[model samples]
Target: MTAFIFNNLNDMQANINRNKLFVASCLSLLVTSLSFGIRAGILGTLGTQFNLSASELASIAATAFWGFPLAVVIGGMVVDAIGMKKLLVIAFLFHLAGIVLTIFAGGFWTLFLSTLLIGIANGTVEAACNPLVATLYPDNKTTKLNHFHLWFPGGIFIGTLIVFLFEKMGIGWQIQVAIMLIPTVIYGYLFSKLDFPVTERVASGVSTAEMYKSVGTPLFVFMFICMFGTAITELFTGQWVGVLLNNVTDNAILILTITTGVMVVGRGLAEPIVHRFSPQGVLLISAILAAIGIYMMSTVTGSMLYFAALIFGIGVCYFWPTMLGFVAENIPKSGALGLNLMGGAGMFAVSIYTLFMGGFYDRLIAEKLPEGASMEAYRTAAAGTTEAAKYAEAQLTAGPDVLKATAIIPVILTVAFAGLVFYMRNKKKPQLAGA
Candidate 1:
């Protein structure tokens, strides 16, 4: 789809309720991100409470990631045709169901299903709002998308505070998950009356076949693979923060707060950075910084971990939004399908790595344990006893092992993004055949 240039108001005026749309869109992503934060905080709780192994727990987390790609890719395909309103409503219903099911979760399978539902809802919100935001502020796609995405880390900051507060008060984790509903409901209500502009794809009258044609190219396929590494590197590490540090320090949530807080601030300041580095240049540097940050985080304890988390947070801050923004800017013909697929690939890839990292920890933890240590006995052992204590020791070592393994993803990404930067710069911007 050729971008609809709003050279004359009579041609295509974008004078909708932008402030309300922005607020609703931020809040939409807020609930999605809030689930991530709350999930991170409760990971250890779920692990011990349900006697789940590292792999089992990660499988449950994987369910959350697994549901995202389907919803995002499918919703992206029809978001323009069906209107943003229906997708937002679907998201609201799924969020409500997912939250309730999670609170009443009986065990691993129940939690998995609940989280899967919530992930679908989260994907739907992204599918709808990303295109909506781009349409609303066409002239400032990167900056506006960054601001819209700031709520992701902003919501993490809020959820982390709630987790810390609730833990201090002896409140149940269910209440923490439920607390996300406040913003969920607010966004749902705000969107009820809001009018969403058609996506640029629809406005420019791009056919579905044309959208496929653009997205099916080798360049788009390569980007799909690159986004996978980018998402897993940012997401799985963030998701595992609480579990990784729980055995190392009582201050796990504090570390989460620090990292997410840095992300929020970094995104708020992204406007000037986008001006300085351009999105592709910034992404190349981000991959480099993320690789160093994860490697430095191998300590998993000590005061320096906080500093490392800050570096990691700033490194990943621009990745998600700018990746999408690049498509909006450079691959305009791919339309909403390309945007959603990029995100879908990222989320889908993270789900796979969540499971992969879990299995890695399981293997590493086993190697460190006594030769005859029975896994089931360790699971059932009383909190202060020998097997239980050995398990605790295993967890501490596992945290760093997983981080060390995960650090390689960003190293690969550093190389891949460098190639992307080269591609973005040296090549003339390609025009759509019909444009």
Candidate 2:
């Protein structure tokens, strides 16, 4: 009778600890999304204040992407060795320092380095939390991962609102940057008190050699390539909303807010959708919608932009988490390293594509100007009264063109995911037939 009571107490305590760990993971991811939201809000401000070109602004933004892949790949490799708790501790320290450095940043390099630190922190969050969630809910990996990742878009929704309201109140960007510290501190505190579990691979007794071998499978390779497209389709567009849609909308950042808002809702209700269609089917459908939405966004204007953004939000809402979930389900042997590598690959692709988009935007702007007009001359004229309208018109043209080109990425993904869906269905058919 005493042993039974003790066992029940132990079970209760374990459940309580699991809940705390999950909550802490969510808060840590919240910091990452908040940073994304706030950075999107401040991109234009940074450009203007620092007298930066589009490419330079992109370089600054792309630094985070570079740092993200670096940290996630390394953290993924070592997570089993050093554990999730230590990775998160590193995240907390980097986040704290990054926020402070960004707040006091005077120029481009400071901004670049600070954002890199924050990016490392963001990657570390995924490195720890994704595997942690997969381990915690082994039977329900896809559904639970979607639930865990909902906080990403949810946090962005909250962060955008914070930026919007604070901007209305005439607050500076530094304050907006600093506000991220609240959730950071909370997650840090929570993690400090909680005990972490071993990664799913460890708990399941998958050998390290087997884990490495599994990631090289043909399907895993295909998925790794697909991650590049899906990530750029979602993240590149989300991050560039300020610049891409600035001329078309009065408050372009609201487009990000609205998009993320839809994402939060979609991810919140993902269980039913994922179960009904299966992850592969959902990926195919999401790819189709994302293609159409990006194309529509390029062509649409005014209030119609909101509707296009809604379609896009729904399209990308399931993308990141579902991709990770698919691997966790299909490539269980690949384990935490596979999950981290998938994420890292996506960010690495985005970093390269971000630079391309920035350069593309600038090139388009240059082409739209008078035959011999220099960007420097145009900037000088626009600052005064004479060419401001012309500059605006050029942005109006260039921005949509950029979106039009980006639309091609999702179109390719649609074809790829359709193939994936078909392959997965057929792959299951033989077993069913034999059974």
Candidate 3:
């Protein structure tokens, strides 16, 4: 009886652990989405309240995206040595501290600093959970990865919806921002109670030299560049959509809603498609479609904008997860650190462009607006001969050109992907000759 109960208890414990970790992973992503949604909701308010220029707001955005790479890259390097649970705990502390700081921020520098903290938390969560999920479901990496990432979009949907509801009820943006704490608290509790396992690198007894050797190769570096391009293309485009469109349409959140919804379903059903097309085929097709979709977004507006979002959503939906999945499959030796570095590369690209786009918008408007227009013409200005009005007018006109600038990124990606596909096709020729 004792032996039988012990066996049954062990089986029960095994089932409980996987499910708990999955939920914790989802909640971690949920915190990220919540932070994103709340930040988007208040972006305009922050700009007007603090008398912030477009570039200043962009700095905050840059700070947030930049923090991801710092934490993820470092977390990746140490995750195997320190274990996933400690990284997760650090993320939790950052989330708690960052959210509170963001809520109390009254100026540009303060907001930037707080957001940087949150970004660290966000990156650490992703770095730790990604390898955790991959380690748990080794053979089903792509399918499970798709499922794991589904929560990012899913949390986006929930968060944006919550803010939308609060807007209808006349709640302040601060409260909307604070609502993120609910999930943050829940995830913290779950993580506290959960037990984390060693990374696959440790379990498989892979050496430190072996891991370093794999990531140091030429092929890996080239792929890292491709990952950087693809990441910037997807992230920068999404961040700009809110800023440019918020004033143009009151229903701006709906665009985010539609795009994220499509992404959820697309990722949910990724398994069969991944099997049929192969990771390389999927990436090539994704790059092509993303270019076409981003072009349409640059050129379209109104109800038709939703259609454009759908196409763009489906195009970029697979880029993030599939990139991680490919590295996991192709470079298993590099392990969790490799995964973190790949993701960090993407976020680093995002941070750079966020700052650039921010500065670009400020400079673009300044070049046209009368010098005094910067100080006076804002929020409530009307269409007339006033300097503020002219500045406002200039901003409205500047939107399209900014988007056109973004379109260049995906075009570069399309060409890069085609070349990669060609190289992949001929990958074994040299090795075969040596044989």
Candidate 4:
């Protein structure tokens, strides 16, 4: 069977209703905002109670990423069998459970468990919602996707404010985590009442066998590989920024605000950029630039480090949603399952890297310490150390291997992602061959 493609304007416009699509877009933003708010927002505030060691804290921060792959995969199947609306309900419940668990969590294991569950819920939101949004507004997939993605940064913007408010009020992290539920509840209500379109792949009446067959094509595999790398970049950056900064200096809380602020501004500015470029083109630049940004970040100090983070934020801003747009643009007929599966694969990739990077970062940070040192010796070493002294010492006395390793991972992944984009650009030349 030949696959369907929406290359014409009329066909695309006929596929969606403008007003209903706006409502759906708003829902996507809500999902992005809340998802990130919990993921990154919790890190700055919640760290006080959890008191996770640098590495343990990294794992908790990255745990949500781990659930991404599995949830996306399962969500794909669920969206296909049931519907996007039902999956949203399930996602909401999981999020609620995870948040509640976070409030009562007593130890590393409980917190880890909560982070994992929350990650699962967050993954569900991406898996179900991304495809639904594309279907709701098929006429301008790339532009619309960018608009939908605005909420991710937008949510982070709101989340940052909440973090500030809580800190000012002297309220604990648990309350901050709990407070996110208000948006979730409000969005859940709105999403429940709206009627979403059937997924594009299904609505096109593409058969299951045909859809399954499409996966065997080289193009799908290429996109999947790019997705894996993209996931690692998007997740580990946000998840570990606080830990990395904390590892280097005592003013981690202040640095986190700066990093999140940079991210919000970068993402806010991305809306206009998306209109002028192809999604794949946008991703190609982001991957390469991110590599340079991370490399610079590992080496810089003082105000330079802050500037590098801003640069890094700009590089990574378009990654997550643009990757989805790549799929929606190239694989217009790929129903809910297709989008969900891509999300699942990407997330699963991130989970692996998150665990690996967390362990790697922790082990390396630990190795920086001189061997056989007692608590007394370590405390003495820490005593009277100026904030700059700690970071400078950490930068020097700390082995260069781990810092080098961090840059190497993303650089290698960026090369691979670039290759995938090249493959995708050429793949369309012989599109009928896949059939």
Give all candidates' CA lDDT scores: 0.85, 0.89, 0.79, 0.65
By descending TM-score, how would the candidates be arranged? 1, 2, 3, 4
Highest TM-score model number: 1
Poorest stretch of ten by lDDT in candidate 4: 426-435
Q: Which is superior by lDDT, 1 or 3?
A: 1
* Per-residue lDDT of 200 in model 1: 71
Candidate 1 per-residue C-alpha lDDT over 105-126 given as tens digits, one digit per residue, 9 for 90 to 100: 9899999999999999999998
lDDT tens digits by residue: candidate 2, 1-435 = 545653454454464478889889999999999988889888888888887888988998898898999999999999999999999999999999999999999989999999999999999999999999998887788998999999888888888888889989999989999999999999999998888877778755578998999899999999999999999999999999878889898988898898999999999899999999999999999999988888888999888998999999999999999999999988888889999999999999999999999999999888888788778667546455556666777999899899999999988998999899888986742110001
Candidate 3 collision pairs: none
lDDT of 4 by residue, 157-196 (tens): 5665666577679877777777767766776776667666
Per-residue lDDT over 21-77 for candidate 3, one digit per residue giving the tens place of the 0 to 100 score: 988888898898778766775677788778787878888888878899999999999
Q: Please give the distance, in angstroms, between residue 324's alpha carbon in candidate 4 and its true position after superposition.
A: 1.3
TM-scores for the candidates:
0.95, 0.94, 0.90, 0.83
Query: 332 in model 2: Cα distance from truth in Å?
Result: 0.3
